[model samples]
Target: MSLLDLSWRNMKRNIRLYTIYFISMLVGVIIYFTFAGLMFNEDVVTAIQNKENYKTIIFVASMIVFLFIVFFILYANSFFMKQRKKEFGMYILYGMKERQVASMVFYETLFLSAISVTSGIFIGGLLSKFFGKILMNLMHYKDDISFAFPLEAVVSTILLFALLIGIITFQSYWNVRRMQIVELFHAKEKMDKPLQFSMPLAILSVLLIASSYYTITMGGTSNLWKDYFKESLLATTVALIVGTYLFFRQFSGWILQRMSRSKNYLLGNKMLWISSLRFSIRGNTVNFTFNSLISAVIIFGVGFIAVDYAVKADVVRKEYPNDMIFSSQDNRTQQQIEQILNDSHPILAHETITGIQTEKIANRKPFLDHPDYYTEEFTIFPEAQLNAIVDLRGVGEKVDVKGDEAIVLTRGIDQPKTYLSTLPTMTVFGDHTFQVVERIRFPLLSIPTDASGGSEHQPSVLVISDEAFEQLKGTRPITSYEVYKIEDPKTSNNVSRQIYDIVKRTEGSYYSAFIDMYSIDIESSSLILFSVAFFAAIALFALASVIYFKQLREATEEREHYAILRKMGVHDNVMKQIIWKQLLFVFLPPLLLGLLHSWFLLYYTVILIIKDLPALTTIIFSVMGLYVLTYMIFYVSSTSIYFKIINEKNTR
Candidate 1:
């Protein structure tokens, strides 16, 4: 028979074994094809505001997906090749040339790739409309998306996967050509030496990881990070990578060794799996460490996206309480804005806030420690007017100012400690020294000015008693904000645009419209969330498949040991218990450590910026629960397949 016929028969015989590999490839193809289709979809391109940016983001995301698929396919191919080494060896022993065997392997891979790509593209085309609708909904686009199988996307996907298949076929051909017959026959029997614990390395691993965490969390305040930020960041990343590797390579083995020596080591089938794990630790260490790090990345990425999407509206509203805000010294300009808003939408509330701006404050000593905390200009508001504005917005709590006391609001500062107690007293106009009663992190108004617009400078805000404010009103440059809350602010884009044009043309005047800023934020965040969700899905799938494949390979190697235990009168329940323990050992460590790492990362980074900690915590836990559920599904599948392999009658 020709090599092609033999290769076809081999594939048919081993179809069951190829099921996971084929599914993984199919999923990769579907993701790539779907993303490509969206990139070329006319509806999506036209509906989104920034067409170039949208296309660029999708293109970059698709490239990343393609790279990941390449890695996954290559890894899967290597596993299959390793599993079939003995078969290749037998083919050589039966007088078949090595070239023939290699050709056969190539043909098998080619056939599998063709089938996977064809089926995957067909499914991807069918799912494109559903995914498009999801993207549109996330982006808050009202237009209906019509499905079209873009010829460009189809041709591009075909060409890319075809190149991938060619590369895979060449790799299989090369791997078969280079393998010695003896090496192939002995490949299944080859195992790493038993793990040896090293005290020095274990200690180093702990120190490395601990120091890296400290650097990431606390280093921002340190001079090293402040002065050499890039270097510090790079060092932290390197330390984390090396530390994680050492953690699995040495620290984990040390712990296992200690556990094996414990008094209860031989209890309840512990000896069965514990002994096996100790021997296999050397082989599994790298995989465990890699999966752990990837898990952390996946969690951190998804957690940030979830929190960002959840809190976007709240953040926008907090920053801009008034649906439309503009400052104008010209009464005619103000009248024009009022006319524009009144004609376009129903007005919910309208209020005016008068404030004074100062270039300097007499009590600058409090800000000496962090000069950036002090702005060149300060916007001072009277307690009554500020309280009225807050009450009108119906979002924030109303503040009360007592005699000679002021409440300070720092623009864009999220951390409470950064603003609270840092400013105890303020002397405005170089004469009136007021006691600082409380400090708020966000600004009261959203308009950009010398007090709020400069880079790296926070706008200083003070709300004093009404009597105190009247005393200094004539001494400083006065500014007034015409704030308006209109009906359906989020949907009033056209009205916002009209007002924006008028405000931009007026001298020394600016405006903040809720729809303008909120739409950009919501759309960008929605796109990020959509992309990240899929990336996380792909990572989880890959991680699970890697573990599944490794477990299956190990099961094949340990089948004889299991068969011997069965003959020695081990019960079915007892054998299953052993398998469960072994698989749990493989799956649990990475998950727990990854969770811990991600939790710390988010706490130090993402959590600080978020206003709603309780909501963010809920989102994080939900993500964790979902991640755990996915792993559990894979764990159960691996265990069942492993049990079947071990209990098979013909394991030769």
Candidate 2:
């Protein structure tokens, strides 16, 4: 058989052991393909036709994620290469030249990588349409988008993977070239105990971990992400990674010694469990470090991902009841404008009158917390604009302050003259003394995320009752809200004409109409693009962690332990239970903590977007489910490898 056929046969012969590596690499390719396609999808391009920044974010995020996947595929392929050392040695012993062996390895990898990557990308594209629809639906976008299997995206992702595979293949070739017959012939020799790390390293690790986590939770909210940001994270991560590995390196002895002395908590299977864990920790310090890093990466990556989604999905729309909204200035009378608007669209809701509130917000340092809160200069609403707004949104319902008393509600403000002033300022008009009430929630289109991703703000009408409307006389004339609700939403195309008519009839100026679909498209796309990038980083860390541990387990000693345990009459069921327990120790804590972290991040991000918390908590469950489904697939594949080791032990 040709080298291709021989290598293919060898790969199939050990398919069980190689499947995890293959599947992970394939999934990475798929994710990259899907994201690349989505980023440049025709619909997205058409919708954001002239928006350069949006495309830039899409490309930058895609490139970062794609490069990450490349490194991951290469890193992951290393372990598979290590595992095949014995087969390579035998190929050499059977008089196969190293050059031919290199050719064989390259062909097999190229064939396997191509198959997996192509299949993965194909599946990813097939499903991306559904994903796009669901996302658009969530934002209540009525626009129909076309999602073609983006050939360019597929080609780009494939070329990247192919290049990565070539690098890994070359690395294998170098390994074969360097291997002497002795090392290859004795590939199954036992491993020796590794030198322990110094005591200071453990303490350092503890300090590093505590410090890094503190920085993440505290610093992640910063908007100055362009500056000292990346450096700080890099320094912290390096400290954390080195320290953790060192701590785990010597951790086994310390743990075992303590547990052996404990009279209560150390007594039964607990000690054994601790012993096993400590053994794993000591023997697999690198693995433990890998796991911990993965967990932290998951927390950080998902935190950012969820937060980005929440910002666009829930926070940004908090104050805008529609695509565009502004309260009018109080001095102007908007009665004629409201009437004109009412006369035009029979189905449009009337202009809502809201009680304007005024407050002299003190200090104001914390109000606009983020540096990007607002621009330096913007116009405050004039009295005429306020009156026009009142005409549009005024609750003509009068408050009977009491007999012979009238109170006027006014838009109140004491806005500071800085770029940071976020809350609006209002001026009370007329002779009415309007007392300040607590700052109320602003209006925004509150489309809940339904199965189809509906994006529409709710209509709420709240104003002072008739008893509260009268206290003192005001100069501003009462402008009754005039709105018409039509049964069909689609027929509201003429609402702009109605507004213009109102403007002409009332001689009204500064009227605005809320537009749809475009805004929703922008917001949702920005969020999903961020989400895919953040999640890709997390997935990389998780895959690295799982595979690292598996590599550690495959090192000669751990497999021998399985052999010894079987020979000692341990029940197969007990052995299975132990493996199960081991898997949980590795998997559960991070998963739980990562999920809790996701909820917290989601909560904060949502506040940034919509200025309200999600009423339903099921999203937490959904996020958790998604994580488990994806991460656990790799975990399960790794554990099944243990069973194969146990079988090898028994046969011996």
Candidate 3:
């Protein structure tokens, strides 16, 4: 057959295998683009928006996804090469030039890349709308940004994979180039010699394990440890990864080599264990390597999201205990609020607070930027309305006033404009009556009920007294409600809902605190689930599928070689042992190393991620167990197919 004909035939014959590759690529696109959409969604973006040098997080995350795609696709290409090695080797023996064969392989890769990319992009377009909906739900997106084709993001994604395919094509060519005709034809005859452990390797492994433990545990979180030990911690992680590989290489082989020595203990499936372990290491060199890589990724990935969820989950409930939060323009509902709270729940901690928004003046006179802090916005606010809204957090607490004059608290700056890095400037207008009081800080978290142009993002108001607020706000009404922490927030919500029913039937503009809390919870949960599902799918599918596919090809190749030994008088049991044995050794080192690598990764991720330590551990362990179970099942299924193929070829 002509070279073009050979390439075309291979594509058709290997269509099933290529389908795996194509599907994986397409799935990866869906996953990554979904992640991008989530990050850029308006609700989630509010958290990330222009927050002090935070644009880099999106860029870094995107780059990681792009690089991962490139590497993963190329890794999958190894299967195409493995399946075709015999063909390439035989063609060379039959007088087909190496260059000609290389050209053919390159053409096949190019054709495959083009086809896969086209299919992926087409599928991506269809998935985007559904994907967008999922993202909106996750972010609890109250606001929306219009979605278009996103030519820039999509085009960049395409070019990235194209470059990756180009690299894969060249790598395939390189493999073909390095092979001699004899080795190609006799490729199945190549054997992996048993490995022996060196003292240096064993010592290094011990040292690496020790260092990794110390670095990861880090004792506790502190600026002192973080500043001085960060680099060292990173270095130790690298060491642990390297050490895991080394340990696996020697330890796995050493165990198998010593297996036959313990005949008494070697009874039962000891043979299977030994055999499988060896074969795993040998035939699955790359598989083992990648499994380790994935193990590490999951350790960090799941740990981060789970921990963040647990921590934030608690804080949000305490901050907003009710369903609907609203404030009016006046402060006259103190008695009504108490009545409602008593009516809603018997256990109510009723209190009234007053607050005022700060004002500034260019001269002795003052002008208030946002004076609505004295107005009654929410029905649950304090009696005088200026108790806690004015003069809070950064600008207010640090200032001092003498007699009629006041200087607002402000940070000393390297430059005038840059002083407000995380703070706002104290403004003044000409000839405005301004009296600065003693600056003081407000509470950590509170939303502005003062909607008369008062912003929630800026510094807040603090009320010194009820009378002061009443004088400032001019008969504004205060928010009225019962504030109490129940034994169960979940149950508290239900009770509040019941009370809300009562309020709604009897009055206008009546809202339940329970509804507000429930809505926020729903929003947060949706976003968390959205992020976890999309990212986890990408990580799992890419890492697991690649290892599984590679292992399948390797098993097939090993089955061919094992059959030759069977004909040379090795017993059937021995033949099976050998086949399983090779896989065990090949798989052991990489898989074990990968697990260790993941362990350290989980530790570091826990440090950076804000959360409960227990949750992080749980997620890491769960993901690791999952990878192991999936791999085991895949191995069993592939092994059966592997032996079946060999049996058919031998009969032929």
Candidate 4:
């Protein structure tokens, strides 16, 4: 028989073993092709209005997918070769040259790669338009997308897969050269060696993981501990990687031993399951650790993306709660502002807030031990104007300032101690002082000069009685703001963007600053949301591939032990149960640990990125649900494959 005929027969015989690799490659190529089509989609490009952005996303995402596919396919090739080492030894013993054995293996890999890539591209092309619509929906694009051939995408995918197949074939050819006849025959049994661990190493692993969690949570906060920021972050990341590996390496066997100590638990096939888990752990420490970290990375990365998108979208409304605010110097400018406001949309209501500027303003917060804080000049308003604007905007109740008391609009301080402790009194321009009766939160009439853009300042806006305001009046420059509320605030978002564009076109406009809430939300959220969602999908698919490939390898190695159990009167039904239980034991630990890791990640993420954004809670829960569903599919598929492998009647 020809060598090609023999290779074809070998491939047909071992097609079941190649299932994981085949599916992984197919999925990878499908994603690549679908994204390529979307990148070239005319309607999508028009809707996004940025062709380069879509192109860049597709290019970078494709490269990431390609790299993952290369690593996965190469690893799968080596794993299959390792599993068939004994068969290769038989070939050598039958007077076949090593070169002939290597060529046969190469041919099998070439055939499988060709089939996977071809099938994947055909399916991907069919689904490309559907995924394009999904992307358009995510980006809030209104263009009606239609399907196309995406000939360039097809050619590119084929070329990329061809290169990948070539690389895989080369790896197979190189791998068999190093295999000796004796070692090849004993390759499958080599993993049965006993594992050793020390108490000190085990303790060290726990300490490292503990310290990593601490650093990630509390060590990165600023103010006092800002200097060691880089060091703490670096230490935590390293500790997590090394500690996670060591933990799985030593902890696996230890767990199995402890579980076996209960006599009732070790009864029947329970002990066999425990034994199988121990063997999997001790022999595959690196694989277990790798899969665990991959799981953690998927959860952490996807969770963060969801949180960031939600926060960015929410921040726009929080920053600009009112419809529009524009500063004017005098009546002429104020008239222009009113004209533009009326032109933008039907203004339901408007408020004119005048600021009497005062410098060298001293508040109690700065004089306290918090000397690092500095106070800026403030715009003081009288009680009546404050009440008029507050009531017109329907934000807060009108404040009553009594005697020498004033209401301070504080900005930029999250902690109450830093803001409220020094608010007992306020001094304006040299030595004039007034008692502070109340301090309101944010969104005052005039635009805040602070970074937060809210009323979170140290006496930034002081509201006093008209009589007191008249007394402190000086030659200092005055600033004014014209705040307007439109009849339909939601529809006015587009009008707000148009007005902003008009202002940009016309130089020296009346409005010193413009706040368009909807425009800000849409402009920032679209790119961030799309990029994060795309990358998350890529990472998740890659993680699934890695875990799936690893599980298949484990199933292949454990087949013989299961065959023995079948011979010892183990029924097929009982063997199926044991196989699934064992697979679950292997999969669940890493999944649970990954969730625990995400908990620590989200703890800090909520406080920092999604600060005070209540909407993120719902978004986070939804993301978690999606990830769990994906994991469920992976688990079910893994169990099914495992059951099929261990129940086979022939296990030579």
Candidate 5:
């Protein structure tokens, strides 16, 4: 028979083994094709107004997808070559030249790659429009787009995969030509030396991982170690990576050796499983470590993306309780603001909030007890006006300041006692003294404007009785706040844009934290959320396939060991249990370690995103659930495949 016919027959005989690799390759290509199609979709570009940056983001993402697929294909191909070394060795023993063996492998690679890539692109074409719609929804684009075939995307995917296939085929040819006759037959028997754990090295690994985690989660609310942030983070990252490698290299084998010493635990069936795990884990340490690290990143990255969106949404809602807050200290008046709002659009519900604006005394001691408090003057509001606009009881007790007493309205800053303890009586503008009654919270106005038109170092506000406000003969500037709620909240973003444009035309430097926060929310939520999620999905699938294929490859090597156990009166059910236990040892370590990494990573994300532990915990759980679900799929499949391979010998 010709080499082509021989290669085809060999592939058919080992179709099951080839199917696993084919499916993995196809899934990766399909994902890549779908992402590329979305990137090149004309309708999607038009829906988002054809932003060059969006296109750049999608293009970069597609490149990453391509690189990931290439890595997967090459790695799987290398392992498949190793698995079939015995078969190839026999062809050599029968006088088949190395050149013919190379040709056979070249043909196999060509056939498999063609089938997977073509089928993958075909499937991707069918799903491209749906993928585009999902991207639109994720980016919050309101415009509806019609479906169109992405011819450019199809051509690009085909060319890229064709090139990838050529590279793999060339690589196969080179690898086969390098293999000697006897070495090929014994390639599968060449296991790495038994792993030995050094106590000092193991201790160093623990220290490094711990130090890295500490460095990552350092500088709590106040950013206490801000100066050390950058250098420490870089060092910690390097340490964590090296430490993780050392941990897997020595930790698993060391622990298994210790466990084997326990007579009761390591007796009989347990001994066989432990022996299998110990012998196999040394060779797989690097892979398991690498996979664990990637899995951790995927879990944390995807979870943090979702949590970031939720946190930004919450911040936007809290900061902008009203749709717009138009404040100006210049010749701009309440009437001008109202006219601008009315002339451009129909008048929606609006309210004008007025407050007394006074500069704080530069260095005045209000109360002698608190040294950390930097006392400052604040805009004072009368009880009637304060109650009209703000929730009094929600912050502090509603004050009935009978005489000269006044209450302070404040935000939830860290050191409340340092600020509140000295608030019973305070001096304003160097001469005016007022009795403090209570401290109310500022819900929407936590951050106060500074001289530079940003948040001040300290945030403070005062609330006094109406009688006190009217009786004040102090000469201080008074400011008015005009808050507006749009008729439709859905159009709030567009209205904000319009208002910003108007401000720009008038050369106004009106600063609204709410507007700035809202803009950031919209931009980041759209840009980062979907991209990270897509990569996370790809990482997850890659991880599952790698672990499944690795376990499946070992099935042949392990079959003989199981055969010996069967002759010694071990039932198939017991052997199955042993396989499950052995696989669990291989699988659970990486997953659990990855989860440990994810926990610390997610905690650090919470520090930036929400700062509320319980809320972030909920987000973490939801994200972890997605990862666990994906993992279980491969775990079940890998275990079943392992069982089937081992049992094949028993059918004889």
Candidate 6:
């Protein structure tokens, strides 16, 4: 028979072994093709405001997918080659030339590649429009996405995977050519040396991981982050990676060794599983460490994006309380705006807030860093006008200030005690001292703050009693803010644009439209969430597949050991229990560690950025729960497959 026929027959015979590898490659191709098609889709490109940036993001994401697929396919191929070494040795024993054997393997890989790529393209083409619809929905675009298969995308995916197939085929050829006959025959017998537990290394691993966590959490508040931000980040990353590696490398082995000596080791099936785990832990250390780190990253990345998308509306509302806001004292301009807004949408609340901008403000807190806080002017409003505006919007609580007391409104989400404590308790305005009694986090007006202008500092507004405001009003220049809350602000894009045009025509005018900012924020957050979610899914699939492949190989290697145990009267039920316990040991540790790592990372980082902590927590835990469920499914599937492998009747 020709090498092609032999290769095809061999693949058909070992199709089960190739299933996971084939699925992983197929998924990779589908993701690449779908994203490439979306990037080239005329509808998506033209609909998005920042077409170039959107294309760039999709291109980068597709490239990352390609690289990940390459790594996954190459690793699986190498594993398969290793598993088939004895077969090749037998072929050599039968006097088949090494070149011919290599050629057979090459043909097998080529056939698999062609099938996967063709199937992936067909499936990806069918799903591309569905993905486009989801993307457009996330962007809040009203237009429907029509299905169109871009030939360029198809050609690109074909070319990329063709190159990948060539590389993998060459690798198979090289591995086969490098194998000595004797070595190939003994390949399955090569096991890693037993690990010896080092007390110092175990302790060092704990210390390193703890130190890494400390650095990440405290780095933001310490001089290390302030003086050397990038270096600190690098150091933290290296420490965490090395610590995680050592954790699985040394600490896990040590624990398993200790368990092997424990009284519980005498329990039914415990000895069987624990002994096996202890023996194999050394070889599996790198895989365990890699799985742990990738799991953590996926959890953290997906959780953060999910929470960000969830709270996007809250964030937009907090930053912009009014639907339309612009500073205008011109009667003609105000009348024009009122006429346009009243024509289409009902004005929910219209307030002309009169305030004074004064640079004569003193008693600024020493802890505040913004030079603007100490030098720049502050907009001071009377308690009556502020209360009226708050009542009109129905957002923040009303303030009741007496003669000498003032309420401070700052730009940011409210943090209990943090903002109140940092703000000065007293302020001096043009020689009149007033006590600052209360602090509100969200800005009452939609005027731009220093933060909106790309500065780190937030703008402050002082609200005093009408008596105190009258006392200081004549000392500073007066400013009037025309703020309006219109009906259905989310759909007020046309009115918002017209307002923006009118406001921009007047110099020194400040304008903010809720719809304008909301649209941008929602679109960007949705896109990020969509992208990160897919990326996480791919990573997760790869992780699970790797673990699955490892366990399958182990099952094959341990089949003989099981057959011996069976002859010695070990029941199938007992063997099944043993397999379950063994798989649990392999799957649970990395998942628990990953969950813990992601929880800490999000609590310290995302909690500070998001206002609604309870909602954020819910989203995070929900994501973690879903991840755990996926792993559980993998664990169960692995266990069943493992039992099936070892329980098969011996052909020998």
Q: For this target, which candidate reaches the highest TM-score against the unseen true structure?
A: 6
Task: List, residue by residue over 554-652, the lDDT tens digit for candidate 4.
Answer: 777778877887788888888878877887777677767777777678767563655677766676667667876777688888888777766565744
Candidate order by lDDT, highest to lowest?
1, 6, 5, 4, 2, 3
Candidate rank order under TM-score: 6, 1, 4, 5, 2, 3
For model 5, how many clashes?
2
Kindly give the stretch of ten consecutive residues in candidate 2 with the minimal lDDT sum: 405-414
lDDT of 4 at 291: 65
Task: TM-score each candidate.
Answer: 0.80, 0.66, 0.62, 0.76, 0.75, 0.81
Q: What is the lDDT of candidate 1?
A: 0.80
Q: Determine which window of 10 residues in candidate 1 has minimal summed lDDT.
A: 447-456
Indicate the residue-level lDDT of 92 in model 2: 89
Candidate 3 regions off by >4 Å?
Answer: 12-63, 93-99, 118-130, 141-168, 174-178, 186-188, 198-207, 221-227, 264-290, 313-353, 356-536, 564-629
lDDT of each: 0.80, 0.53, 0.52, 0.67, 0.70, 0.79
Cα lDDT for residue 566, candidate 3: 68
* Candidate 1 per-residue lDDT over residues 384-482, each given as its tens digit: 888787777776667777788887675444433333454477766777778776666546666442211222344466788998888878756788878
Best by lDDT: 1
In model 5, the Cα lDDT at residue 399 comes to 47
TM-score (C-alpha, index-matched) for candidate 3: 0.62
Q: Which scores greater on lDDT, model 4 or model 5?
A: 5
Q: What is the lDDT of residue 272 in candidate 6?
A: 91
lDDT of 6 at 456: 26
